[model samples]
Target: MANIAPPVEDIAPDALLDASSSLLSEHPDKDRLFEQLAISADRAAVAGAADTAVGLAALAVQVLEEIGGEPARLGTALAALGRLEYERGNPDLEPLERAADLCDDLDEPVVSATAYAYLGAALVALDRPGDALAAVSWSLAEQERVLRVQPELRPTLKPVRAEADRARGLACRALGRAPEAMDYLARAVEAALPRTPAQRLKIAEAATLLVEDLLAEERPEEAMPYAEIAITALGDGFAVKAALGRQRLIRCHLMAGGLAAAHPLIEALIEEARAVPGDLTFRAVLADSLAQSAELLPLLAEDGGERAAERGRESVAIYDELLAAGVEAEGVHTGRAAAALALAYALELCGKHADAVAPLREAVDTLERYAPGNEQLTGYLARALLMLGDALVESGQAMEAAEVLRRATELEPVTTPPR
Candidate 1:
């Protein structure tokens, strides 16, 4: 909903009020007055005077309820209010539902379809994807009906239909129907072209979602173009969106075996993450990401031990800071374990077998405490145990090494392909 643009209008508040006051003073027809109020409210919303828009929309609804005006016209005013709330990123679905009902009562296909589209969008925000999908499907059916019966309404209905398509795509993605989602989102992006900056932001956001779905399906090559499009569409003004796009691109490069490309991209992302204000979480996460990525760094320019140790220490420092800042310990348990494991590996790489023992033990203890009996974490836990056993044996702790190796053997053994 943050992607939606308000009604396109540019009217001065005082002048608009004065003109509306003078016109109302002449006792205009009730229905016409409702239309006038609706127009003013929409303009106010577009001009960023949300309070004024709400007041005017409320007045229009009051006139309709009291004077028995056209139901379709009343629905139009209600739907406008819904659009205002949606553009503000917190849509209230009740009014949109009411508007849809009112339009249905009037047999107004077009307005009802638009109302359903907004309702679906609100439902998507609420995380009710199944219900949202149903609403959007209804909206699309109505749109098709209207287009077939009243071709002249195309100019007015095209954008609303596009909105419904986008909503459907979002709902489908939420339901794990990625291929269908990609298709609908692609259509929506095409339809939303030549829009204002605010509206184009929505297209960029949709493209980003498509990219995510593609990447999740392990189709990095297929996701690259959409990631590029999203990055370009985010422009320079929205730093968060641009950063997210860059991160996705970096992941794509790494997954596609473009390690040299990913190296500089990862560095750039780390720099940007450090510059983000108000939260240290992004920096902590990026530090961890860099530590993992650096494992792929070569030993020609720098020894594997030194490179891994550098990243491992950087990650540990950030993790400690995050903990000191009151970040929940449970939330970072996996990260802490991973950092310790990396440090232990780096020590082993440098032939400091005894020095690696403490970190390996710590990693094993952390994982055992937090993730006991969890199959998904079994592989990681087993690796830590194996490393600890190896370090213990090398340090002449034969009994401890035997015990650790026994535990490691009890857990599942995992295989890694040669790098």
Candidate 2:
């Protein structure tokens, strides 16, 4: 039962502060939602010898057949099994293995195809995109073949179509096909079908991929609603959910040219990264976040407009952090992060007529050294060159600056953030 709350005046500063910082404050009803999930998990985890449990159990094994015991899918299956194991408070690979076995026993191609989708999902989560792509492809082929010839299985296949679309959409997105990925995912969401726990997860994946795609298209205004849906579905306790939430929030600010307003969210993600012991991705992105964050800093200066001086200061700070991180060994992604930051600052202060020689040279040098031939790196390389040219012009090297800028124009246009 709900209790009467105390008067607002009676609350202490610490109490109010703590309440504001609670999970519910950050995410709508997260605590209660997680509690209910735990409850559902508890109830469903207890497998009886009933027909339903036995059927699902066999289906698990069938999925294993399609997976062929690859280590990637095996690890994915193991993690899912681990969650079930924790819930049951006993060693229980039986449920997972049972489902795999069922996939093999099911005579219907549609049912087998659905099982393969689940098995493929396990591979996807294990960072084995190749295996995931292959598995999803096979599942789609089976589903298509069955749907065309064996219309008898339409009852099951129809219900599973949205799930298949959703899974395939996520795989395509992970493989980096933003436009095609969104097409399939849009079908899944428009289906508006009820989701089992399995389908619910696919929904979350599709939503996240769609969100990333929207942002890359320079359409956060379009992405915001999808991000909201994903947050509402995934809740804050899940790791990827939390990380994505932080990124979307920061992006929302940047899209508005309001990066200063994003300090709280940026600081929170920074702290979250710090809390994770040895989180390399978190650390690398944290450096970029810091740079992305300075977008709101004022670029204008009084008389002679010490813009380059101010810009140089910001660039130096970021470079110092990159040096601290030993970013040279971290790959082009990390190095481009720092270079992009300096380049942004240099371009902003272009009219300063200051000795752009040092920072501009440093920016291009760092980018040239670090940017490998990766697609995303190529985009960063373009931005760096554009700013380097601006610096050259400011230093009374107009001809050289024009040449560099022309070179920048030859790069493939960058329209979105990299995943």
Candidate 3:
């Protein structure tokens, strides 16, 4: 019997298992059995059967250790386990780190690069973007050498290449390097096929980021296509992508004069955010969107005052909870400020003029404190000040109302319509 397995070069990963299995059954060879186990583990992993892959790879590791401390055999088994751990979102870095070290010591550049790519992905899951960048960049560098030596390695490198690009792009985006992030994400989308959920997720992420950039630049019309792409590619199972796609779609609807279409989606997103604990950003956006839609409620419904007040109270409560949780991000603060304005407006609608004053002042203070000199917030600030002035006048404080209204008028030209 041949104690050593043939080199896995030029073999398709999916075909490798069957080939090794045939060899193992015919020859009863330890090396063939180990290779079969490694290939089967990889097959499970690529099929999204992560737990099965871990078990198969663990068995292979044990067999290799029992036979002898064979570097190549052990390295392959360890890398398989490490890849599964990364996919499973394990926070502990020891498995991948150890696999990477083993592959490096074995002088197996392809396996080493795979290990590093997965390690970077794991680091990204851990929210360590800087370390993710370093790890993924190392993977890319190693892949460069491996490809140079064996150009046929390209097929085998696809998943690692795609993952490395995603990790790098996400890390760059987290660090505020938007252009670089977009470029990497674009490459990631190109590298991945939009077939499997895992593959489509990369495309969805890239498209969503592109849409957000366009929206931020006030090009909602241009952003529509990418949002459609993300929403379609993401399908139904992706909660984060679905929320983001719906969020962008609602904004596009509002900009395109389709408030009727936007209202229910906004409500749905708010309720969805309420159900998911860590989705504070989406909750803040839902609150902001609901506040924006409050102005249109009277036109949309006969019981608009009650409906708008309910939404405004919900928005305010969401922001309050976020603030109490120590979330001081600019997006959260902006949402809180916008919610205050909506709450004040809702109170005014219900004829509670004196009760509206506090939220109006809060809107003004939050806007000025967090978003100073922002043109968008300038309009909102002026409106909030005017609302405060009106509330004071209605509450029998004419002297104070005059000074507040004068400040409101002096801050900006009256570009905004009466609230």
Candidate 4:
């Protein structure tokens, strides 16, 4: 009898990896070792130890490759590793491509379908939408063939089907087939409907994509429900994702001209950001979002200027903290500049042009320091200079305003095309 490994849930991720490594060194049943490693990797991923999961999955593939394991086993290991890598935001197409090639030579329809599905997803992430479409087409066809032969596996393949559909939707969108993308994304959402708690994340992902599509098309009413669905599905456990969902929901309301509806959501997002123990990137994102809300709200509501000023101050404070912390990333500097610009705009909206001059000067100085010679930032620098000139004029600094305006006009034209 083959040696079966103990349950992964019974051990810590680090301990399981250590044990798996020790077992590999002993040369005990190679196939069984591969299975144990694969199981451990999946369990680690489920437990949110993404790095450990990728390590285990990579080890599994290495073990199989070293011993010249069967193509089916090797393909499975490669596919698992590729999937984990993609989830970890460091996608590489090599493993997934190799897994798909191996599947082509095997008779295991389910494994072939699963491998292709993962390949399609990775291709989408890598921005090869045309290739992604072909891969997902093969995956869906293979899945259909399996269902024809063994309908009983339908329940097991729901998540796989949803994954394939979502990949197809993203591929179509990238290919500029808007209507087709919407249909596929809607199907993906339906296919991902939760049958268990574990399935909720899938549903949230699909719904989020669909909402983005709808929002892009200016169909905010259609986007609202899916945005809400994504937020509800994420619940409290996935704070970052839930906050993103709220941001999307807020956009839906704002686009539909419901400033009142968006207000509470914006506040909720601020509260969530403050409550969550997130890293610098999350804080930067929250600050940017607040600045954007502050800039937009004043355009939508009569009483919004005061609220915008409040949020703008908060955004500027966060950016100031980030800068004081010695974060030197270009994005951090740009975000701080943008926060200052937004605060100035809010202050001007509140009829405080004199007060706005200070922030406008800060924005102009920041951009002048960081944006020159960078094509992408040229327009931003010019805009900041122009705004600063106007603020100076309003604050009765006519001579300074003339020089600032002349400098703004001397900037090279921003000719870079949008992506």
Q: CA lDDT, every prediction?
A: 0.74, 0.53, 0.74, 0.79
- Which pairs in model 3 have colliding backbones? none
In the range 1-419, model 2's lDDT, one tens digit per residue, is 11225422233323322343332233343333233323333334342212222222223323444336543333333334433442223333343334445555545455456555555555555555566566567667878889789778766665456656665666777787767779988777656354333334446657777777777677776776676666555543356555656677577656755545566676577567656636655655555554543433332222132343343354356446556777656453344444344444544555543454565566666666555675666666677677678767767789988989998898788753422
TM-score per prediction, in order, is 0.72, 0.49, 0.63, 0.66
TM-score: which is higher, 1 or 2?
1
For candidate 3, write residues 282-319 as lDDT tens digits: 66666675676565576566444667777777778878
Per-model C-alpha RMSD: 6.4, 13.4, 7.8, 6.6
Query: How high a TM-score does candidate 1 get?
Result: 0.72
Off by over 4 Å in 1: 1-73, 105-108, 124-134, 149-159, 169-258, 299-303, 329-331, 372-376, 394-399, 415-419
**Which run of 10 residues does model 4 get worst, by summed lDDT?**
1-10
lDDT of 1 by residue, 187-233 (tens): 78667642434455677889888778777677888778788888887
Highest-lDDT candidate: 4
Model 2 TM-score?
0.49
lDDT of 4 by residue, 280-312 (tens): 756876787788778767765644478788878
The positional error of residue 300 in candidate 3, measured at the CA in angstroms, is 6.6
